[model samples]
Target: MPASLSGQLVVAISSRALFDFEAENEVFEAEDDHAYMALQQQRLDEPALPGVAFSLVKKLLAFNNGGPGSGQRVEVVVLSRNDPISGMRVFRSAAHYGLGIERGVFTRGAAPWRYLRPLSAQLFLSTNEADVRSALAAGVAAARVMPLSRQASAEHPGELRIAFDGDAVLFSDEAEQVYQRDGLAAFREHESERARQPLPAGPFKPVLEALQRLQHEPGMRIRTALVTARSAPAHERAIRTLMDWRIEVDEAMFLGGLAKGEFLREFEPDFFFDDQAGHVESAAAHVPAGQVAAGIAAG
Candidate 1:
C-alpha cells in the first residue's frame, strides 16, 4: 500500500525555505538552471546552513519524538522545483542536521505547489511568491518564507510559538485595502460596521485550524498568536472571524499600526507570518519571519 499522510499535521516546504540556497538561487536567477544544477551537484557533500524557517521546522518536528507511535502526529515533506539530483543534497542536509524528513517531490523547474493536494498539507512554505499564491488559491495555508529573516533562538526548545498578522493572513485583505485607500478612520468604521460578520478566510486560516487540532493532541506544546496592526473597533471583526470559524488562538495583539518588533521580541515566536512587508521587516529583526505574499499587499 502507498504511504499515508492521513491524521497528520503535514507541512510541505521548499528546498530554499528549509536551507540556505540563496547563493545557488542567485545563480539560478542570474544565469540558468544548468549552472544552478551544477553548483548543487558540486555541493552535494556539503550540508546547507539553516534558512529562516529551520528553527520553526525543527521545533515542530520535535513533537514527533515521543518514541515509536509519536511519528504519526506530524509529517514534513520537501516540495521543491529543484531537480532530483539537487534533491539528493536536500535529503543529505536533513540527515546531516538529524532531521527525519523522508519524503520529497522534485519537479526540476516546474511549479511544485500542485503536490500540496496529494500530500494533504496544511501548511506550505516556500520562497517563491508564485508558488505561495498558487497554494493559497488552491485553499492551502501558504506563506512566502523570508529566507533572510532572523532565525529563531534556541531559548524555547520545548515549545513552538508562531505569530500571524490578522488581515491578508488569517482573514482576507478586504479591510486592509480600506485602510490603505481611505485611511484609519474609514478602516475603523468599516470594521465596526462589519464586526458581526466574519471576514473571509485568508491564506493562513487552514494552517491555524491545523495548529488548533495539534494543540488538542496530548504532549503537544504549540502556541499561536494573532499579532496584527488592528486595534479596538477594527479588532472586533478579526476576533469575530476566528469565533465564527470556531478556532481560538493562544494569544492576540492588536497593535493599531504600532511597530511589532519589540512586542514580538517578548513573544519570542519560532516564526511569525505577516502580509505587509513593513510588519515583516520589523518582526524579522526580532523573530524568524515569513511574508504571506497574498491579497492587496502582494499586488
Candidate 2:
C-alpha cells in the first residue's frame, strides 16, 4: 500500500450531489424491467464525475474485491442511506455489473458497519440524511482511532482532505465552455467583464453546501480545495461564486496552466477531481485522482 493510503481514513461520497440517479422514471419504477434493465446496461457508459467522488467509489469497489490494504489498518463502508428508495437499486446495479461488494447489506435503516473495522479507504454511498450523518460521525470516530493522524498536531483522525476543480465542481459549466471555446485571453476578458454576475448551479453545489454545514461542526472531518486553471482576472468569479454558493473551500488555488501534481503533492489531498484528462494525469501521480466526465462531450 502507498503511504497516501497507509494509516489514512478516506471515504468517497455519491448522492444526488454528484449523480442524478432519479432523472428517469424507469430508474425508480418497479414494473418496467426492460426500462430498468436498459438503465442498468447504461451504467458502463455513465459519465465520470468532476470530483474524487467517482474514483473513491471505484477504489471502494476494489477494496471490496480484496485488492490491497484489507486488514485492521483500514476500513471500507458504503452508506446508501440518503435516497432510501434508490440506494439499494444503485448498489444492486453496481453489483450486477460485476463490482463485487460481498456481504454488503441493503437496508432502509441506519446501521453502523462493524465489518469495516480495518481498511485504508472507506467508500460510502449515502442518500439518506441520517446515513450521510452516520458516515460522517463514523469518520469522526475513525479520526480519533486511526494511527495515521496520531502524531500529527491536528486533532482529527485522517484529515481527509478533498480537492476539486472549481469551474465545474462549484458553479455551472455554462461559462467554462465559453472559456474553453474562446481561449484564455477571451475567457478572461469575458469573466472580468462579468465577475459579479450570478453564477449558475453546478452538480456539487448542494454537496458543497452540505460541506459548509459540516465545516461549522465542532470538529470537522473534511477540508476542501478548489484548484482551477483560471488565473487572476478570472479568479474573483470563483471566489465570489463560492460565496454565492455559500460553500467554504479551505484552499483555493488559481493556476494559469501550472502543474497541479506539485500542489497536490504538497496539499497531500486524499483525492482530487478534474474534468480534463491532462489535469487528472498529472494530479493522479501525487494524489488519489479521478476525472469528472460531466459536461464533457463524448470523445
Candidate 3:
C-alpha cells in the first residue's frame, strides 16, 4: 500500500513561515534570485533561527510518535517556493533544531498551494499573502503568518493551545458582511434573532475539525480557544453555533470592541488566527498570530 496522510492532522508550511529567513528574504526582495540562492547555498551548514510559528510547529510536531506522515496523529510538511539548493538549508536547519520534519516540496518560485490538495493538508501557513489567498480559495485553510509576531510561550511544553477568531474563520462571514454594511446594531440584532440557528462553517472549519480529532487521541493534550470581538447578545449566536456543531472550546472571550492583545497576552496561545488584519496585528504583539484573509472583510 502507498504511504498516506489519512487520519492525521496535516499541516503544510512555507520555509519562511517555519524559520527566520527575513534577512535572506530581503535579498530575494531585491529581485536577485541568484544572490538569494547563492546566499542560501553558502549558508547550508548554518542553521536558521526559528520564525514566529516555530514554537507552535514544534509543539504540534510533538504529537507525532514516529515522524511526519508516519501515521501519527500529526504530520507537518514543508511546502516552500525555495529552490532545491535553498531547501537543503531548510532541512538542515530543521535537523539542527531537532525537528523531525522529513517531508517537503520545493517548487522553485512557483506557487506551492496547488500541492495542498494532493497532500491532504488541513492547514497551510505561509508568509505570502497571495499563496495564502490561493489556498483559501481552493478550500484549504491557509494563514498569512505574521512574521513579526511574538513567539509562543515555552511554559506549555506539555500542552498545545490554539486560538481562533469567530467570524470568517470558524464561522462564515455572513454576520460579518452584515456588520460591515448595516453596522453593529443590525448585526447584533440579526444574530440575536437567529441565535439558535447555526452559522455556516467557514474556511478554517476543516482545520478545527482536524484539531478536534487530534484532541481525542490518547495521551494528547490540545486546548482550543475562541477569542472574538463579539459581546453579549451577539456572543450568544456564536456560542450556539459551536454548540450546534458540537465543537468544544476550552476558552471563549467575547471582547466586543476591546483590543485583543492584552487578553491574548494572558492566554499565551501557541498560535492565534483571525480573519481581520487589524485584530491579527494586535494579537501578534501578544502571541504567534496569523491572518485568515477570508470573507467580505478582506476586501
- Candidate models: Cα lDDT each: 0.88, 0.51, 0.90
> Candidates ranked by lDDT, best first?
3, 1, 2
RMSD of each: 1.9, 14.5, 2.0
Off by over 4 Å in 2: 1-158, 218-220, 297-299
Model 3 vs. true fold: TM: 0.96
lDDT of 3 by residue, 99-194 (tens): 879899999999999999999998999999999999999999999999999989988887889999999999999999999999999999999999
* Reference-based TM-score, model 2: 0.51
**Clash count list over all predictions:** 0, 14, 0
Using lDDT as the measure, the top candidate is 3
Residue-level lDDT tens digits of model 1 in 73-150: 779999999999999999999999998899999999899999999999999999888999899889888888888887
From the highest TM-score down, the ranking of the candidates is 3, 1, 2
TM-score of each: 0.92, 0.51, 0.96
By summed lDDT, the worst window of 10 consecutive residues in model 2 runs over 142-151
